[model samples]
Target: MKRALVLFNQALRWHDNLLLSEHAYFDQLIAVVVLDPAEYLTEQYGIKRASAQRLQAQLKLLLDWQQQWQQKQLVLHLRIGDTTSCLLQLAQQYQAQSLIAAEPTAPEQYQQLKSTGLALRLYDINSLLQHQLRPDLASLPKSFSAFRKQREPELLVQRPLQLKFSGQFYGETKLALDTVSADFISRYHTPTAALLNEAAALERLTKFIWQQRAVLHYKQSRDALDGDWNSSLWCFYLANGSLSPCYAWQQVVDFEQQQMANESTYWIRFELLWREYFRWQMRQHNSAWFSKNAFRPPLDFSAPIPDKRFELWCKGQTGLPLVDANIQMLLHTGWMSNRGRQNVASYLIFELQQDWRLGAAFFEQHLLDYDCASNWCNWAYIAGVGNSGARQFNLIKQALTHDPHGDFVRHWLPEKTTAGALVHWPEAKVQLQDFWLPFLKQLKSKA
Candidate 1:
């Protein structure tokens, strides 16, 4: 009997999953998910690769998938250890002829899959644009506009695949739950906002586009620091592969066709293209994408020995109300607005003069919707080391423009006595004068 081991990493959903749908012909198939311990261990950056909150969110996704598959009389083996070793051992025990998985954009993940040295069938279902139709990496555009111009005319998003199984699938094994802890499983089994399955993802997409008609005002309110309908909030689902980009793209196309076609509708697709651009950029630059300079020539920049400033920035004690408020929001909740991200990134790189990678690492640890390519590439863009070069935002100007009434700042940072624009410039207040004076003097001296 032919048997196959299917590995589920980021692509956790059953729908639009080419890895499982295309392999339905196998007589017997065993699905496995391995949780790599290294992801929870602290790295040289003094932070865990995945924070407790992020792990909690991920476990929730896994549990949701496990329950759904069990309804179909199929078991999803959950293991904890080195990814490649676990997959190989499982394949050997199951006597599977081949391993199947979704193609990974991250270089490290690609290397891990290749190291297994087993017969592997990979599918490119994670991205909106299929791998075969993507531009040659050697000549890929260096800017988002150039990339969009070249691909928009010929944009093709395949219909999401529907999986139907007619073969004998493996049942729960003795070793299925041996490696994982009951407490760990039970902790996330209870419901919370982070638990998002494929069904939840689809419901949210419909609500945003059709029910509330929030897509019409997305361009205007997307910059708000905190709101439910301001942005699509699809990143959390897309980041974990619970929702397919192609599926999301098609939904927008249908919305325009049946409802209305405006700049707001067009901007939704534009953002998706930006995501595609970063993924390809990461593929093209590989390790250079994570380097200190990031696809640019080396500079004489060095992080402080102790990095106390970074610590202050992370803890929301920067004395800059707008920046501190944004940091607090991220710490309290694993979300941040796109405009907030740009301002805080500019503050870290241009105002604070700290290493951009440190800020990127901090976000990786905290962001629930973190995509490595988008996170790192954006930081590089603000630091002037990325494809589009440097982008510096005036924190004062940004705060005044976006949060003119200081509502967002006051909501997150309630300790401040200053009101209106004074909240953004704490140095202007006599009581808080000493708090931000040093930073202002430092900036002046640097100038």
Candidate 2:
């Protein structure tokens, strides 16, 4: 009897899952998810690695999977502590023949699993295409545009696997719900948080692509700060692997074939490609991406020692109306719009004059849909310390363009609203007009 232990992070759903779909291959299989101790520890910025929202989402996801597998008489083990140690301990206890799991994108994570020296097999469950890019780090493209331009014409998105756990399997373990700390739950509960599960994820995708037909106007409204029709909100699912990118892509292709084929339809796929680009870049750059001096020639930079100002920004109290509003939204609901993210991140990096890594760590700690490559790379880009060119937002112009009516801002910043004023352009809280505008103008001119 050859048994296998499945260790997965990121790829958590069963529909398009690599290990769960192929359970028949093993005589017996035990699945496990370790709540790494690192997730609970505080970083230099005084924020824990995982917020209550993220922890709650994870708990829900695991519970959902456990209920599904329980009907089949299988058990999913949920443990806490170091990732590598947990997997090995379980493997030895089960006397498993090998480890089966989805490949990890972050280099440290990938290396951690590989270093176990146990027979391990990993799958690229995160990617849409069946054929992965060759493992040639040095030969990879230098930029995202080049990668997309060269690959989009030839990329093939595979159909999702239709799985059936028909074979006889292990059925002896007890099922139980692990206790999530009361303090954690009490501190992070928000009435507006989205439910985390495969059913909810699929429903969101269906609504966005077909029922609401929001894809038709995604190109135009994607930057809007509020409203469901503005964006798909699929990142939460994609980041956690409850939704499959390939399945989403196939749906878009089907939509175009049956409905109308336009830039909006193609735009969704373009965004997916950007995600793929980051994954590939992570593979190429390895762990170096996390280093402050990862860039070639190293960016000439300095950040003020994190102080009260930095702390205020995190609490959404910096008092710049637009930035404060976005941060407040994120704090209240574990989510924020793309435009909001860009604006707030830019303010943290340039306006607050704080360290970019600190901001990245804060997001890593708080964001429910956080992805290593995307989150860190974006911070590096905005901080002018990435391989890709820097992006600096003109906050004044951006607020005027996206929230001109003040509906988005007012919803999050009611105090900023003036009863008769046409727009809620609140005065800047800090006195920086003397140099802020000219510095931004110079940066824009250079770009």
Candidate 3:
């Protein structure tokens, strides 16, 4: 019997661990993804529950994977409870001589995963620049430009590695679709294996920004919240480890060589480095990143979660256009663009003066790309609770600046209007049929 070498991660949708596994380099390869049911059920220390959207997105990605790689030995292990121990049990079940995974992004989870001593090979897909850039960013950039200034000059955008995981597969798939959560599997929806495979990640990196309508005009337009392609959707893919930051950087390099270059293109890379800095911060701070005393401070995060406020915010009824629109988009689809997230998070944390963790929980619920390191750390930063000291995003100012015309606000909330209020984002409102009545029908047909 070829020695079994299995791989596991929270969502194996091309996350570092699976990327290595896809090389098909193991004999009787056993692929597993164990979901901690507790993560969803646990309240934000009693701040309502994190949105279930997170699990749904995972299921969606998994179903897409199974459709294409049906022959691959993917043991979709849904550990309803005892997630860590379940992983250990799965490794033992297959007699997995070696366990391969990505470095942990969360603190307690890392400690738990590390407890297993089955020859673990933890890799660096977790960091954008790997180990090289983080020490330089320990004092994570207070602003994007400063971070880029410190690191971008040295970034080589290492050529993509086709690290193959070769050998016999398909000897151990202990579980199946019938045994797992059916509702969970249905949430993720993508049309093609091209959508599920690593190729999808690479394609998104190239085509999402540079190819069609590049972010070259992003600096001015990124604040134009309602439009498409204004910002790179790289965060979603990067959060899931679906897309590699370096690969995306290579595309940026390609763009500079072959296409127009500007602040927008540069800004996109800058965000990638920003992401690296946050991950480095996560390693440095651990659980403290999410706490109120986060910046060595004086706030109680364990306070009771305000249900009414949380419900209104999550359901997109915050009376703020950008906030409502972004939340609605996230609810309907298990993803939100970066523009929407920043606006929404600001409203949840600063405007409403609600807890940042409550907002983070909601995002964790729905964001298909919810990376704990980036999401919470960012929420903390914008809420002025992050380790990088004080940084706050004002809600009203953000709206006036980003959606000056109110199209994005109008798209999400159609009935209300401040005629003289939005002088710039003025698209003459055609007497649209009762605001989204027609739009809802259209969405249903597509879904």
Candidate 4:
């Protein structure tokens, strides 16, 4: 009997139903994902204990996804230690034929997977286009505009419907979802009985963005910090493979054929390319993608010179209204908007002068849609240190320019000004310089 196990890691996603729908074809499918033992350890030591708590919370989110999916009594496996060793052991014990997964981005981890001697089958489950879709992502382009131009023509766009297994190896699964342990899901996740798969992801997209020609307005409003429908909620699903990127692009194509194309519709494609550029950065650089100095000078993840100040930044109490509100929302809900994301990231790397890696690590620890390549590559991109692009946002300039009226700043930062009288208040460069002198010092040291 060629029996195999499907590994489940609640690192950022739960077991994917789109993938699991193919489960019926395998003789025996035992799904598994192991939480690395090192997850309990502090990441960079500056925010050690706080990070450990966030890791636990992320695991809890995954557990919720697993419980919701394991209704069929699917052979779900959960262990908190070495994943490769566990997979190999189970594969040997079952004589499984192949292991199927959406390939991971971490070079060292992927190498470990390559050496495992299993017939590893990687599908285009995450990306709308492959990393090399654009000829030049493989070669570092000098500018974002150039990178975007090179990619637009060559987008290998396609949409494959979610997989549904045919044929029957009608055997019962051994594992049950109840055995999994985690509490954050029960405490906070929004309750819904909808089909929790790629189909559902599509349905949500239609209702939110595609149905009403709303995506036609996306290019203009995507940077709007507070629009609920500002951006596609695709990351969390794409990160988990509950929804595939090809399918997402197809929905756009269908919408464009029926409606006149606009920058908003085109912008969606642009962002998808921007997302792939990061993936290619990983392919071109390999291990160096994880290194801090791949683009600019090395980041200073050493220590927070003013430790209390860093805590204040983390807790959303920096006296900066827009930045504070976004941070608080993330701490409460494991989600944030695209504009909100840029605002907070800008605050960290620019205003706080904190190490960009530290900020990326913090995003990985908390973002429900955490993709290693996207998060770190993005951090590098924004910090003038990744890929070939050298762009960095000025947090104050962004705040005043975008949130001029401070609706975004006050939404989660009501304490700064109870009535938002200063919502459009101009930020003082002196305050920014004084608060972030340590960070500028580090950057200057490298210069």
Candidate 5:
């Protein structure tokens, strides 16, 4: 039998998966998902590589995919252990001839997959632009503007593959979920109203563009600190591969043609391009992307041994109201706005003068939409280590501009009842002085 083993990496869904198309030729296909334990272990920075919330979210996606495959009479075997070892065992057990999977963006995972001496077929289904069309790694642009200028002319989002498998299926293996501790799940599980699946992803795209007509104002409101419609909220789906960027791109194109073509509609594409830039950048830098300096020279910098400042920052006890509020929001909900992320990241890297990687690690732990490239590259960019060096935000200016009325801060920090602009400056209110004075004085001394 011409059997193939299909591994679902980042591209979790079945709709646009190129790997599933191999079923047409293969006599029997084994679908598998391997969850590496290394992903859940705490790193040297004292942060889990993947947080409980993110793990839980990923598990939900896998479970949903399992049901979808069952409907088509295919089994998605869930395995937990070393990915390479699991794949080899399964391949040998099933007597598979070839291994198929989506191209992983993370350097470690990418290298691991390549080291497996199997007849492999990998496809780049996660990105908006196809892999072959991208610039050579050696010649890849260092800045987003240059990248955009180069690729915009030839910009083409290929149609997602439509694969329907009706061939013979491989039987099930032992489910690994039974091995997962209930304590781990319960610890990280915060009930969310959002559905993390392909069907829900499609429904969201339709509702955001067609039903609410919100994409029309996306450009103007994308920077807002908080709101349901301010942003497209597509990042959650895009990060996990529930929604293909090509599918999203086509939806926006249809919206522009049928309704109205404006800056708001175009800005959505612009943001997607930024995401594309980071993905390619990660591929170019490889292991260096995760380094402390991140493709840049290390500076003479050392944080305090105990790193009390970082602890305060993580807990939302920092004197800066805007930063603290955003941190609190992220801790509670596993999400924050783009504007909030930039501002808080700036505070962590510049204001506190802590290691930028720690801030990135914190985000990786808490952010529901955390993509490895996007998270680490962005931290490096803000810290002057990545492309387009050192973009710092004036915390007070940012708060005044984005949250002029301090409604966002007050919403998150109910104790900060100081009306109007006073909420942004905790030092102004007598009640907050005890906590604010010491931090403010230390900052001034450092300056």
Candidate 6:
């Protein structure tokens, strides 16, 4: 009898998963996700690889999947420890011919999979138009615009495959919720529990496309720091494997046909292209993508580190109203709007003058929708040390534009009830020129 062992790296859902689809060809199939202790350990940035909020969200998703597989008379095994060894042991016990999984974007995950001494069949579960636009990784344009220009014409979001499984599989093991931290799920306020499963992802997809019809005004309101209708908010599921990008695109297409298609509708697809770009960047660069100087001009290695300032920024006590508010929201909910992310990331890299990687690490730890490629590459972009030129946001200007009435600030910081324009902005501790001047001088001299 043929048996298969599939590892749930990032693609955690059964729907639209290529690895799970192969279940039909195997007699007995076992699905497992290993909670490697190494991931929970602290990194060089002095932050845990994941925060309580992220851990809690993941745990809830696993639990839901466990109950789901259990009802189908199959076990969704949750193992803990060295991932490679765990999977190998499971393979030996199950007598599986080969291990299989969706390819992982993060360097660490790719490394772990390589370490596993098994015949592996990995599928690209992340991208949508892989077959249509298979650009050589080495030849991927450094600029997103260039990449988009070439691929946009051929952008074809494939229909998500509907796999038919026997609904019969071997193995039985209860989920080990205690293996992950309990702090993430307890006592903290989150957006909603609906964010943790494929069913919820589909629910959100319907609401965004039908009930709210929010795509009609996405471009106009995407900049708003708050509100549900302003953005699709699908990244939460996209970051996790519960929702496939193709599925999201399919829904977008349906929305366009059912409703009026406009620039707003196209903008959603534009954002997806950006996501794809980052994934390609990671695939090309691998672990090197996380280095301090990955794709841009080298930084002056003599600069002093700002540990205390970075800490303040991370804790949302930086005394900058807009930055603090965004950080506070992320700390509480493990989420922040894309606009909020750009502003805060700029503040940390340029204003506070902290290492960009440190900021990336913090986001990786906290954000519920964190994608390793997007998180790190965006940080590198804002720091002007990676793809494209340096881009810095004037915090005051951003507040005036996006949160003019300071409503977003007040919403998070209730203590600032008597808010005037940027009232929550404390007196500046570090003047803009302190960092800005050196950056300008370097760029000017280079020019």
TM-scores vs. true structure, each candidate:
0.90, 0.88, 0.78, 0.77, 0.89, 0.89
- Clashing pairs for predicted structure model 2, backbone only: none
In terms of lDDT, the poorest run of 10 residues in model 3 is 423-432
lDDT for model 1: 0.78
Worst 10 residues of 4 by lDDT: 175-184
Order candidates by TM-score, high to low.
1, 5, 6, 2, 3, 4
Worst 10 residues of 5 by lDDT: 427-436
Q: For residues 247-335, could you state the per-residue lDDT of candidate 5 as single tens digits?
A: 89988999998998899999999999999999999998876866767866563333223288888889998878999899999988888
Please list all clashing residue pairs in model 1, or write none if there are none. none
Model 3: residues with Cα > 4 Å off, grouped in runs: 1-5, 8-29, 47-52, 71-81, 131-147, 168-170, 173-200, 295-304, 307-311, 335-339, 417-447
- Whole-model lDDT values for every prediction: 0.78, 0.73, 0.60, 0.60, 0.78, 0.76
Model 1, span 284-400: residue lDDT tens: 888687777887766423432337777888999887888899999998888889999999998888777788888888898899988878888888888888687788886766776
Better of 2 and 4 by lDDT: 2
Alpha carbon lDDT at 170, candidate 4: 27
Off by over 4 Å in 2: 23-26, 132-135, 164-171, 175-194, 295-304, 419-428, 434-447
Error of 2 at 111 (Å): 3.4
Model 4 over residues 278-361: C-alpha lDDT tens digits? Answer: 776676676675566654446333443445546677787776666777788777666677777877777677667776677776
RMSD of each: 4.5, 4.5, 7.9, 6.7, 4.9, 5.6
Best of the candidates, TM-score: 1
Residue pairs of candidate 3 with colliding backbone atoms:
23-165, 24-165, 24-166, 25-165, 25-166, 51-365, 54-365, 60-188, 404-425, 405-425
